[model samples]
Target: MIKIFEKRKIWYGISLAIMLIGLGFAIAFKGLNFGIDFKGGTILTFNMGEQVNQDKVQEVEKVISDFTKKYSARETNNTEIELIIQTGAIETEQVKELKTKVKEEFNLGDDYLVQEENISGSIGSELTRKAFIASILSCIAIAIYIAVRFEFEFGVAAIVALIHDLLITLSVYAILRIRINSPFIAAVMTILGYSMNDTIVIFDRIRENKKKLGKVETGELINSSISQTMRRSIYTSLSTLLTIMMMVILVPGIRELTVPLIIGIITGTYSSIFIASPIWATLRDKKDKKNPKAQYGKKKKTSEA
Candidate 1:
């Protein structure tokens, strides 16, 4: 019998403290660390014909480091080896120098520099706008679905929990100075879906228990509902987490996607158990207090004619 409602403030306070710290870091750093995908930069592609060893790749990276530290190097997984390097805007001479050095150092052919292009910052701005729109639409759609399936308060509470999970994920990215790339938005959308599903499960339990245990103490009902579903939430999240953790450890190319997934899963599970149900209970209790006659979960009787 976990008293989640009784310790509501404690849970809220803990989340507030963590968020505040993240806000402090965000303020100190001036904002999140947006990567080249959001902030336009130069892209250099080379065809190495064969996959280079780790040491060789490091040597090539060292050459690029001379021009800009904010850069990433990735090799293709196909049969033919293709390396793509991205970095912040650099002078024409610098780009030429970098290309020459890589070719000379690796003893490559003239056609080694296959492609080079500079992306505009405006394109990144457009992407940012689209991502923002997509997130808002997702929230709206989720709220509508939950409201229809359960109730308006349940919908609102679930949205709040989803927002909580998003904030926590963003906090981690800001504190760690992780690059907010295109994949970041995809990760966020996936997080919202996962968080919403977990929240709906608890909300469904609360609805069922309300029918069975009429007029029970609001706090007790909420606590019991959360407690009943807590184990299922934990087990499901843990299993998913283990799979994602394995991806993060073994897969290097997709770390951007997997790392955010790991953070989201943890926060999603926490919010589902600790945030959503309590919020719904609080809202119902407040409404009940405001109007004694129109009490929550109180059925009305019709007058006989």
Candidate 2:
């Protein structure tokens, strides 16, 4: 019995506020800290020959600390610990020396070995470009598909929701200062997929219900459709969220990836229900005023003379 569509302004206001906060942080803080994947650096992956619990992680940190102290201003390593450490952009020779020193200084069990990758900022720049392209293409594809399947209004509303979800998720990163890296790109892409699916389901329902319930106000039809799908959305989002929470707790290395993914899921679900649906109803109503066929206002009956 929630007047979700009737209260569209409230949802829009809230979404705007959240986005503004994120944008404000981005502007004030100058943007998120780019990880090695974006800025380019040396990545070290290793197995400690045991479970990668907190103690093992802390031990690895101590070892890196020792290495940095000896190397002084010549080197630095940041721990993202899932058996991975990032040493800010380094030279080929410095990389070789760092590998030798890691072996000499750190004692992993005889069964273990370390791996390293030297990424250039140029490579990171390429990744950034590719990520942006992928996102834009995805939005375009979704808009086209929705327009073909539903209406132009639905397409625009869905894209608005996509922007809403991504902005809010990225805003969290900006506010929290989470490092932007390849994993962050992966998370954003994955979120787009999830957000699109959730929005599509609601859109599909609205389209179906509009057909069945003729002569109803657009807001009434949308509210009905969203109400029907509410439980499903909650179930889907909650299940995914709990799974991600568990992974973050159980896995030591991928927490960096999983945590942001969790935020994306929640926001994606919310935008689909609260933001996307309401916006669609508003758009559909406006379209109805402009053109009768472009609406859910009243269906063209089969027996019309």
Largest TM-score belongs to which candidate? 1
Single out the weakest 10-residue window by summed lDDT for candidate 2. 70-79
Tens digits of per-residue lDDT, candidate 1, 191-234, equal 99999999999999889988898877888788888989999999
- Residue ranges of candidate 1 with Cα displaced over 4 Å: 45-57, 73-88, 109-117, 297-305
Clashing residue pairs in candidate 2 (N, C-alpha, C atoms within 3 angstroms) = 82-253
Indicate the TM-score of model 2.
0.82
Quality of model 1 by C-alpha lDDT: 0.82
Q: Write the per-residue lDDT of candidate 2 for residues 189-227, one digit (tens) a residue.
A: 899889989999998988788678877777788889999
